[model samples]
Target: MISTRDLTGLPDVSSLRRLLQSLAMLDAILSPDWQYRYYSFNCHWAFGEEWGSMRNGSGDEFYALFNQHGCFLKGFAHEALMTPCRDNPPKLWPGLFSNVPPEFSECLNEPAFDIASTTFCIWRYHDGREWQLDDLKFPAGSDPDGSGDLLSILDGTPETYYVWAEEYYQEAWNDTSGLTRDAVAAVYRHQPLSNELVSAINSNLRLEDLADDLRDIGYPNQKKPA
Candidate 1:
């Protein structure tokens, strides 16, 4: 239930590049720690035309997207067994519901999907109330807006969500060691992680190490020259 409005204080995109650069430096410093290998420093995928992704030696993966519209982040516990579908989208909604909370089910209406069967669980937050989408805006051929989930209409920027995704992937890695394709797919289907779980995962990460590395890399205290 953590909404984008709650993360309004996070740094904006202008600072994101410097932050990512610092993360890369931290990744290099933490190379000996197997748990930290999945940490990524590159945000180029945030600006790519299509979904861009990165994988660690352990096979865990993170995906990101950014454009004129907004941004998005997706992480898989491990490489998915299924190939990216170019034609028929997989029907995965029915399978996903069994794992999610009942309130989330209340948010369900007419769900949408991509060719790869990635479901778009759209919801609206306005007037301090959440509303579910009864209809979807499926992407027409070559329509940029149609490409991803219906997030552009949401209230806040994607920066906070991006940070949450990074934390989520790190948690997934920490909670499980050898994730199968089925387990990874299950996470994709049940996209949102619990706030309690997020907090626990965040607590376990050695983010201070990254902060120290950022200082060493000339981004002391997350500040960099223009």
Candidate 2:
């Protein structure tokens, strides 16, 4: 099973936040149609917290909350045996959520993320040395909790996102969709937002069109000052 130790690919908290923002921004640019996009980041999610989320429209989803205290995240992969269901009776796997900071109590049961059905959980304090896990005893397998499937996007790489987006959004992508490898890489690098960069992903989209999305992500809408 993919253990927390195996998650070395996850970037540091600050970088991960930027990566999530970039992913959301890229998805917004690629899919002007909200109904077709699978990712979202809301930096204004609450008074002092930002929420990063992904919902596949199927039964898989992950939610991450960020604030000065740091980040706390929970994910649900319904197909995983560890996931809670009527049959599974909502019992999370051992140590899955045992050690999250009490200050983050609100995130433990947010209705939108469906905490009762969660399969994996992780957290990191703002000044901590590393991302903390609860030392889960995963079942014998390559991806018992489905972290391998869900956390790949958090691997801090543009190539992974590119390959996945090409297949996932291929049917919806058109000439005007304007996806290119370099464009994807640029966003992944958290490059400064620009009209040209926006157009590189979707000719039909412009910074003006992505105003709301950029706002929700708490990303700069205006170009960096020269």
**lDDT: worst 10-residue window of model 1:** 146-155
In model 1, residue pairs whose N, Cα or C atoms come closer than 3 Å (at least 3 residues apart or on different chains), thus clashing, are 139-146
Which candidate number maximizes lDDT?
A: 2
The residue-by-residue lDDT of candidate 1 on 1-226, one tens digit each, is: 1212232332343333333443343333324253554344443332332222344555334343333433233333222322233325534323323333343332233121122233322222222233233233333333222212222212233343334344544464343322233322222233223322223333334434444433333332312431
Residue 121's lDDT within candidate 2 is: 81
Q: Using Cα atoms with residue i matched to residue i, what is each candidate's TM-score against the true structure?
A: 0.29, 0.90
- Model 2 lDDT per residue over 45-100, tens place: 88888889888989898888998888887888888867766263567787777777
Question: On a 0 to 100 scale, what is the lDDT of residue 111 in model 2?
Answer: 77
- Count clashes in each candidate, considering only residues at least 3 apart in sequence or on different chains: 1, 0
Error of 1 at 208 (Å): 24
Q: List the candidate 1 regions with Cα displacement exceeding 4 Å.
A: 1-18, 29-36, 43-56, 78-226
Residue-pair clash count for candidate 2: 0
Q: Tell me the deviation in Å of residue 144 in model 2.
A: 0.6
Candidate 1 lDDT (Cα, 0 to 1): 0.33
